[model samples]
Target chain A: MAFSLDTVIYMDNNATTRIAPEVLDAMMPYLSDYYGNPSSMHTFGGQVGEAVTQARQSVADLLGADPGEIVFTSCGTESDSTAIFSALRTYPEKNHVVTTRVEHPAVKNLCDNLETLTGRKYHISRLPVAEDGTLDIERYKECLTDETAIVSVMWANNETGVLFPVEEMAKIAKERGILFHTDAVQAVGKIPINLKDSTIDMLSLSGHKLHAPKGIGVLYVRKGTPFVPFLNGGHQEKGRRGGTENVASIIGLGKACELAAAMMDEENTRVRALRDKLEKGLLSSVPKAILNGHPEKRLPNTANISFEYVEGEAILLMMNQHNICASSGSACTSGSLEPSHVLRAMGVPFTAAHGSIRFSLSVYNTEEEVDFILEKMPPIIARLRELSPFWEED
Target chain B: MWEYTDKVQEHFTNPKNVGEIKNASGTGNVGSIACGDALRLTIQVDENDIITDAKFKTFGCASAIASSSMLTEMLKGMKLEDAKNLTNDDIAQALGGLPKEKMHCSVMGREALEAAIADYTGVMLPMAQGEVVCECFGVTDLEIIRAIKENSLASVEEITNFTKAGGGCGKCEGRLAALLVESTDKQSSPATAQKKKKRMTALEKIKKIEEVIEREIKPTLKKDDGDIQLIDVDGDFVTVSLRGTCAGCYSSQTTLKEYVEKKLREQVLDTLIVEEDK
Candidate 1:
């Protein structure tokens, strides 16, 4: 129950992250002296708008898109809805949507809600994941049709950290002339993404997931894409989205993106090495521990493992005791006497699904932290297993 | 985050009386490994059906271990019949109180007690006909009723522990509870000595469940380098937890319900239910 500055090794960065110092430094001006509205009538505010334009240009440079294509939103979820809703409403004649069953709730739940919200006219075709948590390209191809208005898929999975071939999927949708959108919330920092090279029409990113503050996100709508505003209000975001900017958060997000680009190599190398240490240590020491995502093509800093026969909450509690914060697919969900849909979608058994634990790291994690986790986890697993009726006689 | 009590945390950190008893007059085990908890209870009974000594070894989270320890304490010096009549809620009450999700741990303790008593009596338990539900925990019908009858247990979670039914693949919880309600009526309108043999003793319940596992559940799981262990039994409900490679196996729940519970139902109680402990 005590709080400390004791380097509490946080491996659940996917849940959210501490704001980077550079991001804070970039946002400080906006919160204090430069607080005028970017849409104000005077030059003081107009200069602030110029800074915003420069920030937007930085974002555009990273994604290889034009500054005009980037529209700011509250978070990844809002961006997702905007892309999805824009596509659906722009082409009302086509009422079918092709999406993966493994999409984040921002897309999945919204699609689920459409049945009731739209009087059941919008048909959603949910593609299933393979045992490896990858989508079936052929099955995906089969699901698309002339009646399909939108093809939405996540660039990477939040739980398993499995990357999808959104580029290929978006290309297919392009060939079929269907609008394509991707929730890149989990991949914007860890993986390389170029909007200029791919036929991807829309993409979404959350600022908090990439070490900026929360309450700011981005939606990259490719030039010439059909657009509809989800939020209806003041003429901000060039009428693409409504309301004044989350100026401080948006400034922080831009700075975070700059930091991400500079750290991309370190993220892919140093952070991944720490991640591998955590992963390999758990696997070698803990017998029968199963990794959840594809071994080769996973996020550099995310590891999801299932310890046999133990409940997830118990494991998390023990980890919390050591101030080693992570997450479990079962421990962090809303009321539903079920494991995470992501794990279940991959056909993970209930026995191990209850035991699924996730450790998502960030640039802040170090080798000492990884080693500390390595030292702490096996005993925790063994201790929990001792209480578990499911573990074997050994 | 749940506001766990200090008592709950204390019991969790320092659970008492864990490990299997070597030899004893009666042994009661409850819940399943697949459901993430189970208890093996051993008791020594005097000629007068008085419980002289009791010990327990439990494999479960903090709640299960604490509840089992608390149950062992409660059972000491009590008549076997009195101990058998103890309810899961009573066991929970003894430990101050557990979180709602952890109520099943206390229920497991109570189920284990009834099972130990049944073993001591040498009763030829009947509960040999029921349906399989909860493909995750390997639960059946007769098991649920036996838990209710032996421990005077209430609620869906209690039935789960004593029976290993709803803890996994929760698809069968409602059906298991329905069977439990149905069988209370059936058991009330009873029969004779020969019919009483079908009443389901703790040992008999274990024996029947083991038979089903041997005949059906193990064969399928073994194909996947997995296995299950019979930990405890209360009345008709027999508790068997998962172990080995099976512990982390993804299809483990499917094996429990589709294979384990299904087999038990084919041989066990028609109106009984099987479920898992929390």
Candidate 2:
């Protein structure tokens, strides 16, 4: 299954990125020679523990947070769960949570089952989003109350790549004495974040999303945030998380974060341009192709477009023939009768939601790859539209 | 990913028999845009009741489009009676089986085929006469019951997977669960009851009435921020009180009779009568 860059145009970076070669090289020592337990009371293990500490520092520097605040976990989903569970345990009197309706299932499903988690009834206020996939901040503020334990929102939507004003929202939550957690798995590397100047109590980031390998994630806790351990086994992660360290992935993620900090400008400039060109090309060439998220206030590397009358899964399968990788919000792709919850929450019309395609770029994507996708997308869409019963030539 | 079979992929990629047949003998349409899928089927039947030609147009996902394409292919040259008897499972098997969640797409195909046959024959199908149970999908009680009985479905989730009922806002889950229990009970009992109308003991009637009240009546009402409480049961006369938001609503009587009473009579016994306790 080894694929060459020449053979495939990988535009699904928002789903997961190809591991950076430098990150792999940095992780090799830990994977092979330096495999001693980080907690062992010996020099060999002490060296590994020092590597872990430096990795923590690198991740902290990337987010502009204190090194002590970064606690590594298995993935973004686990980090999200830990943050909310910690807040709920810390504030035992509160029995309500506020979040957006468009959150990834990691947070949405967790909030939906909070009663089971806490063994008591808990109310959840899911703020609705506008057609542009942006939240109504006024509605979000209205949802906060004395019974609200925490407000969990994603920094950037995974489906639409629409950025939320989490910094402002977090500040509002702080003024109300409510803990705030942001799932920044999609936002951490794609945007500039300086948590030192922000009131976000907890932030989650996944490694594989930004050129690191999978199985490594960071949950940042502001220095004085009240905390309780989600995992209560061994006293690892300063008793905040109880599992043994995922050492190799930790090192890889540190390298990835350092690289992300170095390439932030290029990502905004070059990757952003590629994304725009692909979007514009598809919209102009393909009939009934519409953009999904907010026009300007979105991630630079992501573009979601919907081709009416054609199904997204069918469009993606056609793209697969050209080795062009992308994702869709189509019901067929999900194996469910409905499309992505994000699109449905946005009130995107039924005709468009079923055909939405998400193309997320990375620093690795090229102008050539963008052109290739632009070249291939129009005819594929036209062909499917011809097959579609609803499609009519204009 | 759905792990679609090779047959499914072939049908989805290069779907056959697309577009509408001109001067079709019969046509059937099912689903809606808001429901996320729709199909329009056309067929030309000869004087001998043989399908001479078939065509389809679909607006849906892969399985939906493929289901439509597969249905048209299955209908061409098929006898009208044989086509009328086609089941959703038959459509799925034709395409080497759809995903469990996508079974509803096949069900849509079968339903559209039945509708088209009805259109040609000028006879109303039983489903048209059945009460609407799932507003989201326009699935009827007869359709849900048929799917459950044919597939031996035991849960609301299974019913959703098979028929797309309760898959939307989920306001119909209680009704779906009741239908599941009802269908399962009918299957377990012998056909002698349907022929002889067996009588039940007083305790048996009370237990059956209470079970329907708790399982079928309360949940569907609770979704609308309403509740129902059983007051007393004596012989065929059952009394209940509407609590919560349902207590003073103008439609409480209608809810009591149309929904509560209808469900009790269907599930417990046909002679059972429900009265609102003022």
The model with the greatest TM-score is: 2
* Chain B TM, cand. 2: 0.68
lDDT of 1 at B236: 38
Q: State how far residue B15 of model 2 sits from its true place (Å).
A: 1.6
Measured against the native two-chain assembly using Cα atoms, what DockQ does each of the candidate structures obtain, in the order listed? 0.13, 0.26
Q: What is the lDDT of residue A279 in candidate 2?
A: 91
- Give lDDT for model 1: 0.77
lDDT tens readout by residue for model 1, A1-394: 8646465888889999989999999999988999899999998898788878888987787788899999999999999999998998899878678887788999999997885766744656777788789888997886776778999999989999999999999999999999999999999988877889999999999999999998999999999999989998989999999999988888888888888888999999999999888999999999879999898778888899998777777788888888998888762232344568898889988677778899999999989999988999899888867655456666
Candidate No. with top lDDT: 2
lDDT per residue as tens, model 1, B163-278: 54675545466665665565566544222212332234345556767777787777777787787777555433445567778765655545555666677878865433343321
What's the true lDDT of residue A5 in model 2?
Answer: 73
* Candidate 2, A268-348: lDDT as tens digits: 999999999999998998878999999899999999999988788888888987899999998767655678999988988
Ten contiguous residues with the weakest lDDT in model 2 chain B: B189-198
